[model samples]
Every structure is written in C-alpha cells, then in structure tokens.
Target: MTVLVSAAIDEDVEFERVWLDDASWVDVARGWLVGPDAVHSALLDRARWRQNKLWRYDHWVEEPRMGAPARHGFGEPLHPVIPKLHRALEHRFGVALSGPGVALYRDGNDGVAFHRDRDLRWLDDTLIAIVSLGQRRPWHLRPGANRFAHDLQNKGATHDISPASGDLLVMGGRCQVGWEHSVPHVRHPIGPRISLQWRWTSRRGHPVRGPSYRAPRNFSR
Candidate 1:
C-alpha cells in the first residue's frame, strides 16, 4: 500500500498581489505545491469524478468539465493535502474558510464562462483561495459590468493570469461583486488541471442564494 503525503507549505513562499478597481485584488503564488504531478495523478486515479448537466437553451446540457463527487457535511474524508492547505490559508488570511471544492479541467476544451460567484451569502469582502495542479491555463478576469461599464465600453484590458502546476491564486476584497472571472477555452492541447478551492466570508449568517458554479444540478430559467 502506498502512503499518500502532502508536503508542508514553505514559509518563504511569496505572493504577488495585483489590485483591480473597487478594492478587488488577485494574489498569485508560483510553485506553491510540491510534486504537483503526483497530486494530479493521484486525484485522477483515485478520486471519483462526475459530469454535471446544466439547463441550457431548451434543455439540460452536460457541463464542459468534470467535477468531483460532492462531499456534503463535515468530517468527510478528503485528500491528505486539503486540511493542511485549509489551515495554512486560514492562518495566513486571518479568516475562517470552508471547503476543498474540487474542479477538474480536462484539456483545453473544458472551460467555464465568466461570472461572479453569486452563491455565497455575501459577495463583497469575501475571499477565495485556489491551489492549481497540472498544466498551465489562463484564468481570465475583467471588471464587473455593473461597476466598470466605461472600462468595458473602452475595451479595457482583461487580466490573464496563468497558474501552472503547483501554483496558488487567490481573489479577495469585493472580487465577487466587483469583478468577473473565467477559464476560457483554448485551441492547443493541454493536460488535465485540478483546482482545490477554499473560501471565506466575514459577513456570516446571511442567507446564501443564487446560482453556484459548483451546483450544476440547479437550473436557470
């Protein structure tokens, strides 16, 4: 039997923060996870994956990418690295976070459209941390239409940050409300990429509603 191990985070790991308008910012940390190839392989081989269907045009259509089996409730078993990463994030960001919501983008064909996270209880002042594994892919971000209408009209620059294997990217400070993001499809062939995400919000106890990117079972009418 092979024992799975997750390397401890390096204390000296540095992150570059790019501030967007409306107090939104993105933090990128290159080469954060150690031996990401092994991690990606482990997830691909061991974890159960599912295809989610979305209610599109006239009927339900299968989602572009595959998702991990939903683990509802607490104390469920997770990857060895999940808890360690969660603790590190909470300690570093000074906020309590919940999750290891896993997403797998298999090849360039699998991508998500730009959208703000509406499922959270509070969109503003929230933070989401993601650790990327496997091939490099562009994570595109642009100003929200509600806040930066002029920028969009003027063809404002879209920020494209590619998180390679073992990289970490975080978005915070009104990002969900002030900006939109997506993983756009590409023509070139690319390997699978797995993202383990953790999220935090200071405004708690508010009723959580809206279409969640993770909840594909829900329909949009």
Candidate 2:
C-alpha cells in the first residue's frame, strides 16, 4: 500500500486531477505543506476538540472521533496554520474554501462510515478540500450511495486515495451528489489521523445540520 501511495506521489504531487466518474472528481496534491507532523502536534496540543454525535431515527449516536467546525461560524480566530492553508488553497484552486470540519481519528477503531457531504448538496457544483495529517489512511469513494466498502472489489465502482501527512485531496463537481466516500473502520493497530476539511458554502454562508459546540474562546451572552 505504501508503495502504491509513493508511486502516486512521485508521479504527481501538485494538481493531479483524477476522474472518479463522469460527474465527480478529485484533485490530489501530496506533501503540499511542509512539516505536517509538526502541524498535527500543534493542533493536538492547542485545538479545542469536541465530541460529535448524530441524530438518527429520533435517537442520538456518538461519532467515532472528536471534531469541530472551528474554521466557520465566527466562533474564534483559527490557528495560524488555518489562514496559511486557506491562502494556499485559494491560490491553487481559485476558490474561496470555507467552513472547516476537522476530525481527529484517534486510532484504527475511530473512523467515519460511508457517507456523502449531503449538507453542501444544495448547489449544482461544489468543492470540498481535505488536508490529511498524521498516519496515512485509505480514503475510498464509490458512485451512488451506500456502496463504498471493503467488499467493493466486485462492485467495480470503488477507488481509494491513501494520503500521507500534508497531502491534499479536493472533491469537486457533483461529487457530493453522485458519489459516496468513506474512511472505513480499521481493526488492527494504527496511528491517529487528523482530517482538515474545508467545505464549500454560498458566497455569504448558510446553516448546517449537526450538533454544535462552544469553542474555548466563546464569550457570547
């Protein structure tokens, strides 16, 4: 697996466009940031992490990891790295990437199941940027819904992106509507992973569904 990821990195580390289907696609940039490990360490030490949960069938279920949308909602000024990353993304993609959704996968047991960015589906086209940090993990995508999984070989509709630290993956076009993606749960031992997601919104902004939190800096009355 490492070899495969390495080969992709060697072949292209900047703006390599990959077509997942006729409508959805992704842009992969390996090692886009310098010293991603250090950035991960800093985030672990400073970012205000929060537990997440989902409302399903009139009941609540805990998410597999701790996360927060710190880069949105005017909650607080983001870490210095956030601004730097925003600038880089704007320059590379020429789009205003906003509304961060950061997730910390503590280990193999912690991961998100297959799903789409349904919240951003209001538009015809959208972009979602993900900056991977710490520990490489297989990120998979499959067309339509609920068909992305390990037993995806026979389905012939699944593909994966194993991103190393500092790597960037951008899902664009009708990806949210036409494809489902996942970071399947692992049983074996593995290191932690932090996914920095900067998703799209209107030029102004919009409301999102999900449990909210008050950051460490919250001072509202």
Candidate 3:
C-alpha cells in the first residue's frame, strides 16, 4: 500500500517537460531504473496478466490489452519493480501515489483506444504517472471533444509520446479531464511493451457525478 524510496537512488534520472494546450503538461523522465531489462523480464514472469472485453457501441469488444492488477491496496506482494518505481516518483513529485494496474501490449493489435481516465473526473487535481518498458509505441493525447469544438480531435494535432525502457512519463494538472490519451495500434511489427500506470486512487466515497458517459462521436482516429 505504502511505497518507499530509499536515499541511495540512481543519479542518472532526468526529467523533460512537454507543455500542451490549456496549461496541460506531461513529464518524461529517463534512466530511473538501474536495470530495465531485468525489470521487464521479471514482469513477464511475475505479473499474472489477463484480458477482458469492453462494452462499446452497445456490444462487447476485446479490451485490446492484457492486465494484471495488484488490487487496490498494498496487501499483496507486487512485482519487484513497482514499489521502487513508485517511491522514485514520490520523491520527485512530493506526493503519495497508487498504481491500480499495468497494461501490457503484446503487439500491434494490443492497445488502448481514445478515452479519458474516468478516475481523474472524480478529483479536482491528481496525477497519473506511467513507467514504460519493453517496446516503444506512440502514446497519443488530444483535447476532449465538445459540441462546439468537435474539430479538436484532428489526428494531426495529437501529442505523440514514445517512452522507451526505463522511462517515466507523467500526466498531471487537468490533463486527464481536459484531454484524452491512448496507445494507438501500430501497423508494423514491434516487440511487446509494458506501461505501468501509477495513479492517485480517486476518492472512493465521493458521490457519483451523474449518469455514465458515452464516448464522443469520431473519438477514434
């Protein structure tokens, strides 16, 4: 449940800021993990991943990725790299973080579609940090569509982020609510990629905002 970062952390870690529209921001940090190859291999063995279907267009569709969640709290043992990664981010961001799960993309067909993280809508402010491993794919983000700003979904305008092994990518501020991020399907061959989402769990006790939401028309590229 609680993540700890030891003082003898690696010194090679460095962060780069990428600013986006309407004050949104993304932080990319590289060289945080001492041995990324070992970590990635460990995940492949230790993380018991599963795949599910998502309800879209009133039909059940494959979720496009396999995930192995570590439950809500830190009651059980996690893969070796998770806690260390969280602690590193905690030291840098100065806040406690919780990772609900990691999404594993096996290949080009495995990926997430366009959708804002609903958890962010529950909080006024929070952060979602992702630590990447294995493969490099385009993680895209763009402004959420509204009745008047439907043109904002233009594919040419999406922010394309490619995080390699041992890299940390953080999305904070109002980014989750104001913008949508996704890992698009690649057209060519590529190795597997693992993305660990370290997020602040939304207040579970907050009242529901309203009825469930539907993705905007043309939300897909």
Candidate 4:
C-alpha cells in the first residue's frame, strides 16, 4: 500500500527552544499543523481507540485516556498525515524517529499522571516529539529524583506548557532521564484532544522497557 503525505504542515514552522537543567530541553512550535481540526476528526472516526487498564497499586484500573497503539493489528490504517509529520521531524532533528503512537483525551478528566517514557528514560540521550490536536491541555514537566514516583505533584516546581491545537512539542537531550512530564486531570468541561508521539533512542543496542508505572531494575531511591 502506497502512503501519501499531507500538506497540512507549516513548511516554514520555526521552533522555540526551552532549555532545562542537566542538558534537557524542549522545543515548541505553535500552529504547526495547518489543518488540526480535520486531522483530529478523522482520527476520531477512523482510528481504533481502546480504554487500557493497567496494574496500579496492586489492582487493575482503567487508564484515564483512550489509546490506539502504533500497530493497530485490526487492519486499521494510520492517519496519512502521521507519516508526513514523522518524516518532517526526522528531517529537522536528523534522527530516526519511529512509531507515531496515538492517545486520545476524551474530556477534562482524561489525563496521564507524571511519568517518564520507560523506554527512553534510562537511555543516555533521546528525543520524544509530540503533536497536539483538538482541545488544549497543560503539559507539565519537572525534575524528579524518583524513578517511579506514584505521586510527585507537590514535590517541587514545574514548567508547564499548554499546547493548543496544531502545536508541536519536542522533548530532547536528557529530558526523559532527568525530567518527568504529565497531562494532569482537569475539572471543567472540555472537548476531546489527540496526541501523536514519536520517539528515538541514541543507544538502540541497549535494552529498553515498555510503558509501565512500576520501577525498573537498578532503580534507586
């Protein structure tokens, strides 16, 4: 099957870099996707979304949001714009970014807690790029000492960035290792939001883990 790219991206989009401690940084580009509304609606109608239940606190609980894995094994076609966006990122960043994982925030209550991307966190250096569609939501980042802290909300100061529809946010350097990020739950009513994420690892030969809330081996307090 031949995949076609979309013309929804702003070819001249410029990124504003935000540097953090320990060689971590984030790049932000507002209004990057020229057709965010159309893309979001298409995914809502075409993508295979599921409510994942995870093992949290010794019990299985439904995850706050709905997700469609990178490989939707049920013959589902990925958004055509996904490949176009990935290629754009790889060209600009000069790295092989892979897997445009999809996540849907149905409402204000749907969110993810502060946690590192398990596969990328332990690596020496990495990059995780995300594009936001639909409604706007705050993405919080803060330095963390714990490998898997269930609750780190009030521990220290946080840098918050609310990426509106069509915005782009890329976390790079040691951001995964030295910092944690989350889209906290909100109270007021809101429409659905979609996040398209892609990641790259400098040390592909090194072992990496999948998404988990539990602490990994060699984790220190």
Candidate 5:
C-alpha cells in the first residue's frame, strides 16, 4: 500500500463556477494536466479493449429506480501516474485514500441515474476523485428529498459539469451527503468518455461485471 499527498490550488476558478450565471449551486474543480499527452492516449487505447458490463435495471439490489448503463475497472497496481495524482489529492484533502482505484466508460446515451457513493467503509466522510477523459458531457447533482419525492423531482440544486479532455472532479463530505449526482443521456452524438473514479474500499479483490451493474457486495443505496 502506497501513501500519497494532495496538490494545492492557487485559483478560485479552479474550485467553483456557476452555470448560466445562476447561484443554485454547481461546484466543480479542475486539475491541471501535468505529463505528456502520450500517457493519457495510451491509457485510453488500453481501456477501449477492457471488459465492461451494462447494468441491468432489475438486478440491482439497491436503488433500482435509476439507470446504471456501463461500468469497468483497472485491476490492481494502478498506472504509475495515478499514485502521483493520489498523493496530490491526499495533500489537498489532508487525508490518505484507503484502497485501489477503478476506471469506467459511458457511451451511447448510457449513464448513471440519480444516486450517491456513500457506502464505502474506508470513505468515512471523505472525498472521491473522478477524472474525465475523451469527450465532454453534462454531470448533474441535486438535493435528496424523501424517497417518493426524490424519484419525481428533477429540479433541485444542479451542476452541469462540462469536463474537457483530461479534467478532474472531486466530490466530498457535504457534497456527497446532501446531494445526488448523475450523468444523464445526451441527444446529440458524443464520443466515448472515460472516467477514472478514484475511491477507497475495504475489500481486497476485484470482480468483472456489466457496464451498468456492480458486484452485489459493492452495491448500495
């Protein structure tokens, strides 16, 4: 297990930006690309061939209400560059990540419905890092009301994140607790987008699954 530090942000624009100049609450952070483009290109090349699964609507044990299009992972021993980014995130947050990271790709109008990533044991009220590559898309987040109301409500505090090639978004603490996030389907043609979601889990092994479906042990509301 390797320990890493976090990077410092010199500008506020890197932290918060309002969409449409509205103050409803759409916060985003973008990290600068540090190395050669070749590294990212290579990773994308390999990811295209990796196995992925489409999350079935009926199979998910929890939060079966929304869509879980596709999901995949990058196994043990992350790429060499990942540790450096992990270290920078740790330094920025003043805490260390507790487990291995995974990468997922969503394409063809596929997306994750409204939900939160708040079940990891190692997470313990910390942040999860998401890096976007390839094409840009809109990522939305809103407040979670009652179960019945949440399923019906589409307008809450929302953030439309248009992450360009090689951009990073970190959601933590209150952000994950009070809000639910999703990447809705786009009507226009969009190229495949790869997201590297860095998270900490207590489990030791990784299992392959469909694009939308996660392993039963890892599934939660």
Candidate 6:
C-alpha cells in the first residue's frame, strides 16, 4: 500500500486559527519542516543516549513549567537536512536564529505541561520553530494571567493537531509573551515521539561551568 504524505508550509501562508482572542496563538498549519517522520526518527535515535528532564515550577505562585534539556550550541554541526528546514522558516518569518537545537522525546506517560519559551537568557522577540513526529497528540495554548486565575478561568482553547508522520508548528511575536503552550499526555497508546525545537540564544560565546565548580563562600554568612 502506498502512503500519502503531506507538504510543509511556512506560517504566513498556512491556515491558522486563533486560540485566545487576547493572545497570538494560532493552529492547524500543517507540515512546516523537511518531513515530520524523518525528523522524528532522527531525534528519537539521538535521544536514546541523551538525557531528558521533567518540567518543574520554581515557586508556589509560578507559572506552569515545561522542562527541557539545556540548549546545545551550534559549534557542533547539525544534520545537513536541518539547515535547509531552518532557513526556510527564517525566510518565511524573516527572523534569524542563533544556535543550540533542542530535541524532545515523549514516551509512555511523558508529557509537557502548558508554558512558553520566553524566559531563555538569550531569547529575544523571535519565532520558535517546532517539528512534530510520531503519534499525534494535543498541543494547548492559553493567555498568561495570574497562575491560579489563568489555570481556573483560562478556558484557553486547544488544538488537537493530528500531525501524522510529519508536521511543524511555528510560534512567534506576542505568542510567547501573551500565551502559554504544552503537549499533554494522552490515554491512547502512543509510540515514541520526537520533536525538534529550533531557537537562537543571545549567550553564544559564554563559557561552561561544571557541576563541581562551587561558588565562592559568602563571608557575610
């Protein structure tokens, strides 16, 4: 049997629906990358050895958190196919990204809670590109109000994106600031899924500090 594949498009030209009237959330833009299946498989293979994290909230009154691995700088070469895909998005949105590609693996009950990617040290007002691969799941986006209130009154809409084998999601502008997003766990049996998130950071040339490196003792203490 022959499998039908869909094409990816840039955000500007793709069909979109606003989730929250007050936020910059949009949905239903299909395949925005080389191919979701191809990228998904690649990320799954890479993540087999790489570690993953559970998202956390720092404070009681903090916003919902989505844990992600530290950004991996571009000093390491990216898969050749990724550059072409990245460039396509950059041209579409007219924004240049920096370095460190992020890949996420959600298996079993693993899921990402509602949140935004605005707090990165190097992140500015730029678009964050995401390519989805594997089993289809729901991605939710909502306005960022008081944590409690937002979680309560925020009937924030959701997009049950069935991003089959290959699909992409590009979020930008006030989207990051005005809204929060997430990939909730599904009850259906889902095979391993991989998502590649591309973004640029301002802190490129910074040095690395090992875990053993201790801070200087505070004499005042």
Question: Which candidate comes out best when scored by lDDT?
Answer: 4
lDDT of 2 by residue, 149-184 (tens): 436562434678988998999998777767777887
For residue 3, model 2's alpha carbon misses the true position, in angstroms, by 34
State each model's C-alpha RMSD to the native.
4.1, 8.7, 6.2, 4.8, 9.2, 8.2
Which 10 consecutive residues of model 5 have the lowest summed lDDT?
A: 63-72
* Residue 8 lDDT (model 1): 51
| Residue-by-residue lDDT tens digits, candidate 6, 125-149 | 4466676667776766655663346
lDDT of 5 by residue, 155-193 (tens): 453456767655667666544445677877677887666
Best-first order by TM-score: 1, 4, 3, 2, 6, 5
State the TM-score for model 5.
0.61
Tens digits of per-residue lDDT, candidate 1, 67-160, equal: 8842423644445666777888898899898877888999999998777877776876899999988888888888765334544622333788
Better of 1 and 4 by lDDT: 4
Task: Put down candidate 3 lDDT per residue, 88-152, tens digits, no spaces.
Answer: 78888887887646778999988776666674446435689887878878888876654235445
| Full-model lDDT, candidate 6 | 0.52
In model 4, what lDDT does residue 185 have? 85
List model 4 lDDT by residue over 1-221, tens digit each: 32333437898888899998858999999999887887787778767799887655456788899998654346554666677888899999999988788999999999987777875635558899999999997888878764345466543437888999999999998787778888988899999999999999887435555545643223335
Q: Rate the local accuracy (lDDT) of all candidates.
A: 0.77, 0.71, 0.69, 0.80, 0.52, 0.52
Superior candidate under TM-score, 2 versus 4:
4
Better of 2 and 4 by lDDT: 4
Candidate with the larger lDDT of 3 and 5: 3
The true-structure Cα RMSD of candidate 5 reads: 9.2
Pitting candidate 1 against candidate 6, the one with the higher lDDT is 1
